[model samples]
Target: MAIRITGTGSYIPSNIEKNEDFNQHEFLNEDGSTINHHNEVIIEKFKAITGIGERRYVENNLNTSDIAFYAAQNAIENAKINQEDLDYIIVGHNYGDVKHNTEQSDTVPSIASRVKHLLGIKNPKCVAYDILFGCPGWIEGVIQANAFIKSGIAKKCLVIGAETLSRVVDKHDRDSMIYSDGAGAVIVEESTEEGGIIAHESATYALDEAHFIYFGKTNHPEITDQRRYIKMYGRKIYEFALNNVPAAMKSCLDKSGYDISDLKKILIHQANEKMDEAIVQRFYKLYKMKMPEDIMPMTINKLGNSSVATVPTLYDLILKGELEGHIINKSDVIMFASVGAGMNINAIIYKY
Candidate 1:
């Protein structure tokens, strides 16, 4: 028996926000001081570093749960599984549903519960819950499902990572450009297949890096009304991820007993372009090999960073042939990795 991903799906928002759209807005520093650089130069620098030209945002009428439901629905359909047979629904998200123009997050019912309701699954045995593991949440969800299935607790599970980061971003901060809204999901099940999830690794570095990515007051501190938005120390996060993520990936792959040469693709979190490139390079260097061309597929240029949603969304797109020049064949070995708030990091080595 193996814990395998049977199907995958994602919800990419229809509304596109281009980098140039911020040209007329006022960008501010953390101390409420105005940025001396022109908006054009600032945006150019951001694009050059992050490789994000545009990002998607949910419409005013939609919330995080709404998109999560969409992705879950698609995953269920893609998997061709009966809703009543699902054993669990796990959602990973940071801020709950933050409505348009609202600062408060509504999570009383939990996003997983809401998604289960939206999916209309009637089985009482279909347990549902949410996780807060930063951007690695989706992979972590899959790991949890694998545990449940391996422990004889579940047969099928729906794992989703959804976020409406645009609703939680401080528009005046430059990092706000990296935030986007999206959701991704997958159906994991116990199968007789020979290849599946082989190994995984997870870690949290809260001792000194607890607040690498956090929610704090807006950069424009003058208009303070107790409204906090998503904030982060980019330099700290970059350094933290570079120093740790690659090692975690190496550990996972080593545990899987697969040589570095067996890896067909790496679906890493779409946090930053340069940072991701460096992590992959370092990962390959550990094995005394150069990183292979096209070994890592990316979606950050168009999707930005949607936290937990990045990894699964990229996987869904590639599996569905939506991401060009990326394909996974039967029995192919691949890895999924991510790092984010909680200063958390996680990786999974799987066989297709």
Candidate 2:
């Protein structure tokens, strides 16, 4: 039996923050000093290079688990299954529940547990946990789910990827423009069908690269909220991803006993538009073929990079035929891959 995705759903916040709307005033020094920077030039370059126009952010009162709950609700409904039927709730996230009004986090109960509670799931037999694999997290969750089902340890699992990156993003940092907020989910269950998750691959290159994206002190020192946000070396991450992601994808397909021509789509984490394009190009090059632009659908332009949420959210969009250039039919082969903090990268080939 294969582990199959029975349903998929996503929830993006309504608040829209455009690159052009951000000013230099948002950035600051830890001592409350200003960091002088050209906002217009940065936004233009960001839009030109990343192909991102804007990103969504949740209100001050919301948290990661809250959005995860909404996404899980939709996936459960789409799967036509009751919440209690879920054998596990797996959440892929970089940060846990962000404190109200701040980017600081609270991980006491774990986001998955909180989501299960918010969904009113009463089954004591249902297990819940968190997977911290940077941007590859959601896919990692599903991969683990596949393992459980194939081993007869589980019947159904709800995998979720949700992030409130705005909470951890420093408004003054240009790199922060790429972070957004959103949630995506899927219902992975046992199936006797011919296609599901065919094969997957993962790798770690943490040597000096783990600090590429990390937590650090915030600019505001006297503020009551925790002064912590995401910090990174953008160029290094871009280089690492473009160089390694393609190899990971290729290995996954080859290990799955498939070829580039057999794939229908390549859904990737929306970190950088140009980088993703290059990665796909390199992937096909390994097979001595040219990549068809339409073969790899993109959401980086509108959603930015929501870390763990990127894969599942974009997958849901394609699965539901919500994008113009991207669509998937039953029995089509699709590949998924992502790389981020920890220098962790992974890929999975599935029959949709």
Candidate 3:
């Protein structure tokens, strides 16, 4: 049984915020006159580093659900499936319009229902709603949907990865360069046809040492309720990505009964440039494998890291000819790999 991605769609905000615009924001500079060299350097370096020139940002009136609706519409249209056929809507997101105490208990059900109503779908049987592993949530959603659809729990499912990470970024902080807003979606259906999610695998490392990405304390004094902003140990994450992501990728491929040469393309998470290079170099040196030149294009440069939306948004660019000259073939197998904040690493093997 194969779960096919019949249609793919993505929505980027119309607002075009360029590098010079970000540089002129004044908050990017530390002391008004003196700018941080690393910050300024990365803004310029990322263009050449990742190949992303611009990313989309929804304005004040828009929310994740709104962007998601647009992407879903496009995917639905592309899939050419009737609305009545959709039995599930899984939204993979970290930040939502409203805050919640736990990741699992967010307003995703309300979101799914709202989207179903907007689409005029007849009594859609929505199921399995929640935010899974932050940036890796999108892949997790697809895997879950695959299981359900294959098990006869669903005939058609819509899996959407949407994020508004810009809301949580501390604009004054240097790490703010990695957060952006966007959404992307795929319509997965039970198909005997080719080109869909084939095999998925997940692995976790329970390391307290690597848990330096968050801003909250385990035991904070006072009756503290706070909106903790994003903080990352970039060097630590880079090291972690280099060490764990490749192993995870290989493990996933092995589980799927595939070899290094069997894959046609690789879409690693759009976190940063340096980490992506490490994985590519390791594959070349150890496995004697050559990654496609366009595999690690600069998506984070314009959009920053749209959390879960990263890979799907980049997929849109490739499919839309914005990322021209990239060789994606009809029967090509692609690998999606990532090292997310939970000290979690995941990889999914797909045929497209």
Compose the digit string of candidate 3's lDDT tens values, residues 135-227.
787788788888888888798888888877666665555556556788888888888876577677886665663464665321223324555
Which lDDT value does model 3 have at 233? 71
CA lDDT of each prediction against the hidden true structure: 0.94, 0.87, 0.70
CA deviation > 4 Å runs, candidate 1 = none
Task: Report model 3's TM-score to 2 decimal places.
Answer: 0.85
Error of 1 at 57 (Å): 0.2
Tens-digit lDDT string for candidate 1 (56-90):
99999999999999999999999999989999999
lDDT of 2 by residue, 306-341 (tens): 999988899888778788777898889998888888
Quick one: best lDDT, which candidate?
1
Query: Using Cα atoms with residue i matched to residue i, what is each candidate's TM-score against the true structure?
Result: 0.99, 0.94, 0.85
